[model samples]
Target: MPSHVAPTTAEVYRAHLADASTSSDVFAAGLAEEPAAALVNALAGLDDPPTVRLLVTETVAKWLRRDFHLASTAADLLAAETLSLRVADGSFANQMVVTADAVASILSTDEQTAGPATDDPEFVDSMRERCSEAWETAEPFDLRTPPRSRVYETLGDEIDPAVEADYQAMLDAVETTRSNGYRTTDDDRFDEVELVLLAGAKHELQHYDLSRWGEDVGLASKATFSRTKNRLEDQGLLTTEKVPIDIGRPRQRLVLDDRLRDVEAGDLPEAGRDVIDSATE
Candidate 1:
């Protein structure tokens, strides 16, 4: 049963979906008007676009974990989709893609297995229709539900092309994975590694001046970050150099090895070449 405590972030979004005055255009415009708060609130009441939901839920959870207070967990159902949407729209930093893809894929599998096999026929039918629509459409899609409508009305207009494309890709991947019925821990690990590679790349590029780029990615803990950094260094995707950040104090700087860059930019390692291929691709 979905929790009803006050109104979760999802419920707030659901309310937006329920309104007749909302539209994607309105939501898009709201982004500039409100930024993070608007983005957060516009996320309310999304029931369709499972990919969108998955991304939103995951982003919300992460935001919450990082102390971005917006109450609710129903978005957990669609966390991955939201992140993908953010990535596509250019609203988020690029580092979130690998993390979004990996987690969203897992959620897609989980949702399929958790589907309503034991529910009332009417409800089952409703869910089935929603799922079908979700799989077929792009963002700002209608779930044939009031709450979804309100959300659309509120945030739909703001979606950019990148977000739209990435979201479509995410949906396609989710559908493909669901149809295959081949879930494995290896898939999850690949995603983890991919995220690590992405973070490492960002660190190497000096995207941020932080001492621990991998740890800042938010998907991995400090220990996991250390492990991934070591793995990549071993694989030659990264190299550590001692640099002077503070005049007296020296710090370790992550440098991207040209060979590794060639590998990532080249076709040397495809996404499914091996367990860790996903990281490179």
Candidate 2:
């Protein structure tokens, strides 16, 4: 007799989506917040992961996407329906439901232990029915980090090569902030446009023309950047100086306030959050 080998969690997920190019839907249930986040992040890391309609609990939907259509149900209802089983259905013919242990393994840095899976038609049908019911009441969620390609497309062909490196660095920093779990869509935190301005001002040190900076990042309009800049200035988180130009009117040079001047580049997101919290309190 041959020893049975277990498939890794990633392998399991990949197998479920193997036929996904033809279109697939995934119903993920009973995942704790961290593991749920890990699952989405892992999927996004795949070289050619398919875009699936992802059904999840409201709490887990906070982690948004570059791919995957998302819908979420009330946490309690989701918990009751799925219990400890973590389900991901690719299609009628391909379904997977794993134990709590297997779900936890998705977050493991090492080779993830695979949990037992069943493709029984009746079981898959029942699970799908439950998920469909949940979907009826689920809300569509659209809060997501913009994909890099979209951002560049918005920037277009006019970017000066001299400042191209700086722009790329800012984009990298924004990604880092997001990877560290800061979300631009969170109401209590600085939004995406505000983050770009803060990062540019803090790290680049050169006085960029505010309106042009907005155009360079392709995140928001010049007026939007101006408005956000004024708000942050009002909050004492940012300051600006007038710069004379031979062209039209003098441009405003964005600068971090004295309080944020000494903060490290990586700490900006958390630091920005803290300031916002303090201001609100």
Candidate 3:
């Protein structure tokens, strides 16, 4: 149970489930009585269960690409469904707004960085309504053939400018090295490392554990991502720390240094001093 004022997307998803008890307990608890709860359980396999909203969002994405074969339609449906969820009494609605803002933020990363952290609330609120109709039902709603490119054209759009600036600094540091050129065999690895950092930064902001992050980032293996993460730590960009709160295996957690965390929190100006002080402390 999260505090009701604009629960994070993660919290919204979590509140859907019945407790830690077994399925028997869930059935006995009568979660079947609620349509929204039942819909969530039927889709997610647990009554009153917690789920990542991204799961729902991406499910709509996949269905758009594959089943309905209409990428635009799928996006539309998901956007719509998520919107309706927001207006409902459940916390899912608020989470939907957060997810929409995140998507918009990622889409608009190249803009000026010094806003009041409180972005367009009305626009974000509108995304809920606008998006809900877009992804209203998961039924075969494909609209067009998805482009099969692994290197998405939109990748650059998703990169955080702060992360990009930090990586560019790293690139500048290694520019004279024979192995640092984009044409070199290691360049792809470098790109992957930056991507992992970006993904990791988002994870830190969203508070997704590493395993969940791996799933969200669509990595082939959590271990491989960990290896890249360690390489980043070696480069002094991330911290290879463990946390007991991580539901994943021991040594699987990665903590972004305070500097990066500040950037994610829209506190980048303070981030410079904070990062140094925290790292040294």
**Residue 148 displacement in candidate 1 (angstroms):** 20
Q: Rank the candidates by lDDT, best first.
A: 2, 3, 1
Higher-TM-score candidate among 2 and 3? 2
Which residue ranges in model 2 land beyond 4 Å of their true spot?
1-12, 19-23, 63-115, 156-167, 170-195, 198-241, 244-249, 254-281
Q: Considering lDDT, which of the candidate structures 1 and 3 is the better prediction for this target?
A: 3
lDDT values, one for every candidate: 0.32, 0.48, 0.34
Q: What total of clashing residue pairs does each candidate reach? A: 41, 0, 28
Give the alpha carbon lDDT tens digit for every residue of 1-281 in model 2. 11112344545555544433423345555454444544554454456654434555544555433212211112212222221222233222322332211111123336453434555556656776766675565666544333444444443444333233444444444432223333332345455566656765675333344456455544446777767677777776778778778998776677887778787665766677677677777
lDDT per residue (tens digit) for residues 1-281 in model 3: 12222223223333322322222111111111122232332324333332223313333333323321123222333443421222211223322213323212111123211111223658645654544543343233232322212113222335344434443344333312121212221232243334445444534422234434344434324565555565556544556544455466544345665456545333322343344345556
Pull out the clashing pairs in model 2.
none
lDDT of 3 at 246: 48
Report RMSD (Å) for each prediction in the order shown. Answer: 17.0, 9.7, 18.8
- TM-score per candidate: 0.32, 0.51, 0.26
